[model samples]
Target: MNNSKNESVGCIVNECKFHSMGENYCTLNKIQVTKHETTAKDVQCTDCGSFVKR
Candidate 1:
């Protein structure tokens, strides 16, 4: 599916691998949006890469 014009979401990290360009994070840094398969839309965070989950 195509993301809506206003369907934008951001994260709190700047160096995240999932961080895409043109997206705005609520915080000052870049954040990655985690996708949840069973939920309504993207929701679950796969891995922080540099966190305990990694």
Candidate 2:
């Protein structure tokens, strides 16, 4: 994965492969957001679908 950060996207998940190296940002131009439940009611119900384990 590219270590370069995408200014438009901010990410803090260090475990994710898309997370910018050494920064709270994303390397991809865009990311996919998914909901764990049929109707998301809070932040916990949502997830970054683009996340990949490093």
Candidate 3:
């Protein structure tokens, strides 16, 4: 998680193991979004090849 507000806009699936869920709430970090999907943008996960829901 980033301390700077500007650096922490939201979570990104690339940083999370469970990003298939549309939940991006940052429980791990107060300022960060926990590295999960936060938008409808499509991202290709090479490890799982699963579509992330934003």
**What are the lDDT figures for the candidates, one per model?**
0.36, 0.89, 0.35
| Weakest ten-residue segment in model 1 by summed lDDT | 45-54
Ranking by TM-score: 2, 1, 3
The predicted structure with the larger TM-score, 1 or 3, is 1
How would you order the candidates by lDDT, starting with the best? Answer: 2, 1, 3
Q: Specify the highest-TM-score model's number.
A: 2
Q: Which candidate has the highest lDDT of all?
A: 2
Give a tens-digit lDDT track for model 1, residues 5-42: 22344444445433343463322133333544545443
TM-score of each: 0.24, 0.86, 0.19
Off by over 4 Å in 3: 1-9, 18-20, 30-54
Model 1 misplaced stretches (Cα beyond 4 Å): 1-9, 25-54
For candidate 3, write residues 1-54 as lDDT tens digits.
232223233445535443423455222323322323544244432223332333
